[model samples]
Target: MKKQYKRFRLRTVSAMVAMAFVANAWAVDPFTVRDIRVEGLQRVEPGTIFASLPFRIGEQYNDEKGSAAIRALFGLGLFKDVRLEVNGDVLVVIVEERPTVADVEFAGSREFDKDVLKKALREIGLTEGRPYDQSLADRAEQELKRQYINKSLYGAEIVTTVTPIERNRVNLTFTVTEGEPARIKEIRVVGNKAFSESTLRGLFDLDTGGMLSWYTKSDRYSRAKLTADMEALRSYYLSRGYLEFRIDSTQVAISPNKQDITITVNVTEGERYVVSAVRLDGNYLGKEDEFKSLVTIKPGEAYNADKVAETTKAFNDYFGNFGYAFANVEARPEIDRANNRVAFVLVAEPSRRAYVRRVNIAGNNRTRDEVIRREFRQFEASWYDADKIKRSRDRVDRLGYFKEVNIETSDVPGAPDQVDLTITIVEKPTGSLQLGAGFSSAEKLALSFSVKQENAFGTGNYLGVEVNTSKYNRTIAFSSVNPYFTPDGVSRAVDVYYRTSRPYEDQGGNYQIATAGAGLRFGIPFSELDTVFFGGALERTEIKPGTNIPAAYLAYAERFGYKSVSVPLSIGWGRDDRDSAIAPTSGRYQRVAGEVGVAGDTRYVRSNYQLQQYIPLNKQFTLAFNGELGWGKGLGGQAFPVFKHFYSGGLGSVRGFDQGTLGPKDVTGSTIGGPKKITMNAEVITPFPGAGNDRSLRMFGFIDAGNVYGENEKFRLSELRASVGVGLSWISPIGPLRIAAAHPIRKFPGDRIQRMQFQIGTSF
Candidate 1:
């Protein structure tokens, strides 16, 4: 016979006191639980229910324990309903589990990708394989809206749809309707007494829609950009001697349709004060005079906040050079209202000196740890030298393998005199495959292909292959460089190449010069910015006979045979400190190379030198100058090889002249490039009109002068070709592009003028 039983049920708790009262009313006498049973579970495991119960088998159960068991199960958030039933001395647990999310999808989302939306939802705990909840779906919708708003899409709408599927799962889809972005209609500056309103407003990056707004998108409103613009405005005034300048308030307004936005900035331009004096008041390690020399604030000049800040930063960095990592330096100003003058006091505190306890590397998932470690100058357990740390960071950044390299210092927990340096790097793809095609007057049609890996196999080695097919020139080359061939930072490079060239002429010709060579080079680092290279190559040249060939080539081929061989020894030196290799704003670069054919059918000595200097005139303008010189002479009573002569004209040299046409001419009127050359170029570069301050696209006016002289001719300044031109430079997606329109200012009777020139992947 079945045991007699009285059943009691418990549901979710509406109120704690009510649950207890009802539980007590139906409470059963304390009895040892003989068996526990769980029912109505769809997906939840039996063990899960059993573990959540307050009392186990052979334990006493009552109203108090039963209430706790219900609360514990509900806290798991996996159940839609939970119930507890009692039969005699047995406890029955039942649960209806919540449905899990099967998949997440998006529809009509043009502003953002579906994967981005899915990741956003995942961050908020509302993703696939998780229990579905209405509250979490609501939060995900809000998050989607926030992302759209950041892009100036104020009218974006989101609809979340939950479709139930089989096996207690649901699929979620978010449908988005993204409207047009709100544009900045106007920007106004108020309460500006010292400067004109237009001048002050011009300082901000955000502006009314301009002609190039479609490209720049500067007209779009962004709160973060506005905050930065406000800071820039403040800095401008402070740097210009407005010592008490401040931003009073800022107001942003939107149209009723939410299609246009307006921003107004109110500023206070207080009295401009002159600097009365600057005094240093702190311990200087008995080097007060040395520290005093670092001060840049002039006593009689205007009170410029930039100079004050610079002085204080110098003091702090100077202190850090001595291992004081936590140095504090502050510039306090004493204002004299009546005299309209100010005095600055620089206060410094040298904190405890610390040594690097450990040097940790992180975030270089692809590059080897040793690749980054070898570039570091600051070592573990060494004195914390800020200069060395900065140099280490710079060296790693110059490797071009990582998009970002950052170093952070943190104090050790237990040791006061020890710190940890964590170098974090964001690795970027160092390999590139490029395919390009171009059409020109001389080359007609040209195609180029290249494959390069700057950090090959994470080994900090360089590997490259390049192929070019053009009408006048064709080349195929393979190269590899081991940047750290030895432990002492010497670099080794190997190159194998084949090239063919033909003289440019109106009438086509099959006559060509073919060259094949191999070379090995080693670079020795003389300093951080200087490298010396020495190399040797075995080259063979073959002069193919055909029509319209230059007389010089025929003469050389007849005397030295159709084929000639040379073993040339080369030495070079290079120093580059440009801020940017592609779009340099400031710095200088210099290179000198010389080659001597020591043994072979041809014997010659050739040398070339180049210098480039970029001077930044202001924030938006740069003045650049370039100069080059070349000279070559025959050795061992042999004439210089005609194929080794220098050419100067067109895009890279003197614009407005035909390519390789600004040199000596042979009897056939074909331009035979000479053994001596000189070129000079100067440019004033500025931002493109309506492009704001974008450096990637700029316009420049340039003056070019160059000429090539024969081997026996004297160098004459009067014979130098000169041209003036205006050009546009763009760092395009494919490469750097330049287009110039020029007029010859100094030209000879026989000069071949092109008037316009353009090219890609070339720098002057």
Candidate 2:
């Protein structure tokens, strides 16, 4: 009987579908809707039917009106079938309402969340509580397929099943079969005569799977990546003097099983061209010579599109500084095929100056508006200065509370000379809890932890605590910083710390130097790239007696009665122009710090200076150089305190040597440090193999030279120790990791060699 009922239901549904199609052509003589009635509605309201009819109670109805009403009802997408009928002076609307979607379910969907799919379906009118149509179901299926294609899942399949439930509702189930993502089988470049195909392919991010494929994921095929790779290829050729180079075509094909993809790019390598002349053509505002000086392209040099673009951008920025926010700059190239050379004319059009009507902030869902507004150097109602605007944007970005920051200027309505600037920001987490570990031949196994909030409670204040647990060195510290402590952008910071250090771990029985201190500091901004620092600290140092104590430390402990108190005053200056603090490509950073012990058990003066410069050789290569120097002397004819010494070696100083092991040693063969330190490092950095131009993962070859000298020891080249190494730097989920395998270029009999060294979450 159940089987027979199911067959009957199928037959009835088939007949109803046929009738609906046939009704499209059927017409009825309509009359006034004196008392319209509706049937076959389970969820739809009666008024809905009344509102859909074209004829009112007192209006005359005709055959055309009856047909039009039927079409209008169907257009609502709420009914599977709509019909209009008349009985004497009355009209009736019969509607077989579509089922409402009660719930949506997913199975075997790992590529995306079920809610994501439901949200996408909701956009197309197929969500729960809404009418369900078969056409809408088909569109949802296509949307799912599109999403899968973007993930390289070419073999993915989706089956949507609709099952009728109680109360004229249905349950939708979308079963997904997500196969393996398509991998790049091969990348071929055709008609590249100047460069080898392998070399060109090497420039692409997408490639066949390799040993590191699981980590880098560069083997996957993506249309967006392919497009970017093509652009890079074009840029490469243009920058290398192929000014007329053109891409012929590109073809990407998938395998029969959809598990592999191949890409072929065809290009025409035009003849290399050199620059014949460069000239400024438009009004230079009486600064034609100044504008000409900004030109980087020179005659007799290879025609570089990058340099041309840079020169134009410089012109635009220069104009912007003078309130010409809408300046137009163009580089017009005149190619001479006969001589294989090109001439460029720079044209500029400085549009009318405009004042900023308003400065709007957006997308700061967590951070307060004041936090962002305070960083702006450009004010509302002020003439637009491009340099100041750019600086303001960078300042907000440097706050590090946002993942992305962008600014757009739009013309204000009815004000030809007024514009509004909208600053949009995408906020990221401003808090982090880091747990790190490190292993060094000298320090051995060390564990460190830190909890910091850069924007505390969204108030734009920094608070942090840190602890380090190593047998040779242990420390606990607390710190706080307020960047806007002073209305003029001066920053205030407070720090308190306790540290215990064992100078020697190899032959040590816990002979240690301990210190406890607190400090307050202020940073005064001198310019966009410079800052001056002033601070004072009160510290106390204590020495604990133990076996195998270094002679220098023992003598100091005896002379100072095992403890000493000091008041130190510090002054410092710094300048930074790096593009990024984490992964700088080009810029210079420098610092000079000095401290004097004014009134204390130990009176001395210390000064330190450091300089770092990064030069970008090209898009993928950089050269970095760093140098550091330190010196200390005792005042009032007292000896320099042993606890206030400097040590060198290990990752930051000399990678091949053990940590703090390149300095003077005591009689018991323990490193006692020294009063003078010098270190210099040079590195050639490049993108990691198979990682394309990713800066977060890089590899570098470095040369290091450094040593620590005693107070009476004079600086000498012969005393410098050096090493050479290859290293890798990865910005991992937890923190930055650095590993190096180094070899010492200079060594002594007692020098400690530690070739493999690594650390996490700390700078070198």
Candidate 3:
């Protein structure tokens, strides 16, 4: 019965087609009232067109509706042709569909990446698995030609070949003629009043003669590079007080040979403007005084509109901290025509009270979404808090995974009532090696090396090995760190270190120490700019016998010596927004760490602290300062720890002084553990010539001062050893290299202070 039913259905369709054909054979007119029937459809059901058609069965057909129906079908790109036939009291429509593109394949596409070709085609609505028509194919060819032109191939041609295969599908190939990449022969900057032509040309990345120009291909007519040049021009004018600068025109001339290009940029220099007055306008949430203080734009200050706008945003943020989630701030700049100045009026308004819709993170390909979302202080479906936004940016930046972090707020186009927040970031190399070598009088020669992979196997795991060997000391350490413990910024680390050192004067006498431990480190990002980490770990160590050991240390070892164990608890805080990890001038970096023994076979509480700051003086200059302090003590009859102590005055500490030999000593003059010490330095940093702006080849002038003392010895600042010196730092492929030369401002003959000393990769 089922088979018979199916046969009947087929016969019914065939008879309908036959009867319609017979009627059409009687000299049918193109347009007439008749029975309407559709043909030439297989994949697309008949009902789809039947529902879309304006005319019904036996209805009169006009040229307008017939044309409209044909246009609608063609618009779908699924049909090759749609024509109408009219017989007396009958109508028939016939169509032939264009083939669906089952797949897209590329051949000989190394010169132009396959992805680039696919994207070009996709822009013209031609892609894999989509139906294609003649118009679309033609458009694809045009786009291909345009892409080749972008590569400076003026003579390039594109031939599209379509091949029909099985399954009513077709394959497409865009045979390309990739011409040689053109080079820029000359670049001219016109109508420039603020700076010289040479200066303006230097602002453009497209160099007329450069080795890298061939690779970056900026010499080609790149719209992106041209746009960047325009921006550079705008910035150069604004920084010099040009308030309304404009780019009038840009032109590129290709040679007849199609191998050389000449570029011309015309700019309009606007009049420089100055501040006339500063005014504050807008609703202040009963705290105008507080808001006014945060405003950096003063009446007498120069007209820096950017500063005024930033000040306004800061006011809105301040209100956000007070739970005013929808605080709005705007700055109004009023011009003083006679005085040639501008005034800024700051205003704020607290609008509808609302919470956050959802906090979403984007552009983290290697890291999991939960890994980033956990750092958010602002919860999903919670109030939109500016403070939380800033905090989230900071928190994400601190992950050490991103080189830049940017946040944007956008409204859903059709849904004006809804908003979406986007967090975009640029990933950077997290794993690094700290390798160094240098020569110094204090230690004769020195070398320090450390290998660290912060993101092991792209899984956010870290492994490290550190070795510091010199004439006076030798150390080897193996360690591993996980910044994400349970995927929420909870960190963990395991370390094992062994050291053997020869004391100064007793150059042949050696002492050995070893330590092994594992600990957890977690961060609490209380604010966008602040994070604190506190954790503990158990450790075991062995102190081997050696000569040149201080009598105090020897006696202590005899009493409670040889082998011991302990647990150390540590806490640290860090904030780094530096533009560069190795050499930064535009941002700030700060960190503090302290550790104390809590439990084990021995009892001790030891702590150390360090502070560093960087200030960018200019494009090629920076001012930096660093200070370090350490303290150690014994508890429960345990001996004063040797490894826990700090010895200052070296390449990484105070230059011009001997390493480990800077602090005080006993009768034998061995480097006995000092209870406390401090090192302070200030440096003016600059890029080294021949190395460009390489973080590895940095040079600086520095001032250093430090001293160590016994626990009972009075902390005397007046007796601090001060040295002024010049330092150099480099990130060589082998590792980081550092060198410093100093002349002690205050020194006694044979004071063990070296005129030259280096321990690699440290400045000031």
Which candidate tops TM-score? 1
Error of 3 at 749 (Å): 2.6
The per-residue C-alpha lDDT of model 1 at residue 557 equals 93
What's the CA RMSD of model 2 in angstroms? 5.4
lDDT of 1 by residue, 145-243 (tens): 998888888888999999999999999998888989999888989888889988777777788867877877788888998998898899889988899
- Model 2, 1-764: lDDT tens digits are 11111001111234435544444444344445567778788888888877877878889877666656766777677888665556666666777888999999989999898888888888877888988888889999999898889888999999999999899899999999998999888889999999999889888888886776777778888889889999999999998899989999999999999998988999999999999999888877889988888889989999888899889999998888877888899899999999999999898998788899999999988899988999999999899889889999999998999999999999889988888999999999989898988765566789999999999988899999999988788999999999989889999999999999977446658678899999999999999889999999999999988887788788778777689999999999999998878788899999999999998898999999999999999788999999999999999888888888988988878889887888888786788898899999999999888777778899999999999998889988898999999999999876788898999999888998889988776555
Q: Quick one: ranking by TM-score, best first?
A: 1, 2, 3
Task: Provide the lDDT at 598 for model 1.
Answer: 94
Better of 2 and 3 by TM-score: 2
Give the CA lDDT, 0 to 100, for residue 627 in model 2: 95
Cα deviation at 269, candidate 2, in Å, is: 2.1
lDDT winner, 1 or 3: 1
The lDDT, on a scale of 0 to 1, for candidate 1 is 0.89
Q: TM-scores of the models, in the given order?
A: 0.91, 0.86, 0.64
Deviation of model 1 at 519, angstroms: 1.7
The residue-by-residue lDDT of candidate 3 on 303-356, one tens digit each, is 665676678778878887765665677776676666667776666677644555
